[model samples]
Target: MVDRPLSLYCLLLPSQKMIHRLLTTAVRGLSANYRDVIYYRVKGGERLCRTPFAVFQERESGKLSPKARAAMSPEALRKQFEALSGKKRATYAAAARKNRCEIDLRRKAFKQASLSGFSHFIKTTRQWTDLGRRAKEKCCAETEKIRQAAKVERDKMVEMYYSGNAVKH
Candidate 1:
């Protein structure tokens, strides 16, 4: 007969109750199986480290350290925001708004310019044909519209940048 531990036997034919008991003992640092326990040496004394199951349980319980909790709190966030000087905050806000507006305008222009579905095939053919002419005209009109909107947004963003203020404040 092979001299395997009882824990190995329990693993081979695991029931819910046996598995639970095994995990409980492992978490409490009392399991005879070396694989189930983690050891830590501190100040010449051996301490039991957390098993995977215990770590999983702690994560599942949503228990965070005090520092982590405080960092994520609304009051802490407000304090961080208030730490910046008003003039610097305004300058940052204006720049952010300008960048956001420019990005949105560019995205809109890209979407308008990209040919979708049958438009790709229609636009690529000879422009002298009636179908091709119509498609070309429609594409040109859309492009013109996007260019005009971008110009307007550019002017607005420039004004905001020079003034050092966003639309909201």
Candidate 2:
């Protein structure tokens, strides 16, 4: 027989405990997605670097995060704000004052508008409000129907498992 490492021989004839561990690890590996395998292979089994979160220390050092990069130069920042309409410009300014992050000002305006039932965002026309109300009612009805169907399916699954008649994967 050709000379080989003792560990190679041990691996070829694994113990019962080792067999169980090997099977468990194999099953876990088999369950992984094709995308995961490809990504790991391409990256040489190394994990990607994690994004650096902006802490108070970084902010105090006068370093701008990715989101605030556009507002670096005063001239560009002035031009950006000037381009916005009067109402939008005012909203952006107010959001900047309220949020220390100074990013996603439009998102803040939308959140405020949604919380107040779109009072500021929506037109003051009666017909528009009536249409919006009808749409909301329709959406609520559909949501309730879907929730009831899901509850029925969950009950069926529970009954099956408890009755020892669970479906095979």
Please tell me which predicted candidate would have the highest lDDT against the true structure.
Answer: 1
The lDDT per prediction is 0.43, 0.38
What lDDT score goes with residue 26 in model 1?
42
lDDT of 2 at 135: 69
Every model's Cα RMSD, please? 26.8, 26.4
Question: What TM-score should be assigned to candidate 2?
Answer: 0.22
Q: Over all chains combined, what TM-score does candidate 1 have?
A: 0.27
Pairs in clash, predicted candidate 1: none
Candidate 1, superposed: residue stretches over 4 Å from native: 1-72, 115-169
**In candidate 2, what residue range of length 10 has the lowest lDDT sum?**
47-56
Candidate 2 regions with alpha-carbon error over 4 angstroms: 1-131
lDDT of 2 by residue, 119-144 (tens): 22121321223356766566546545
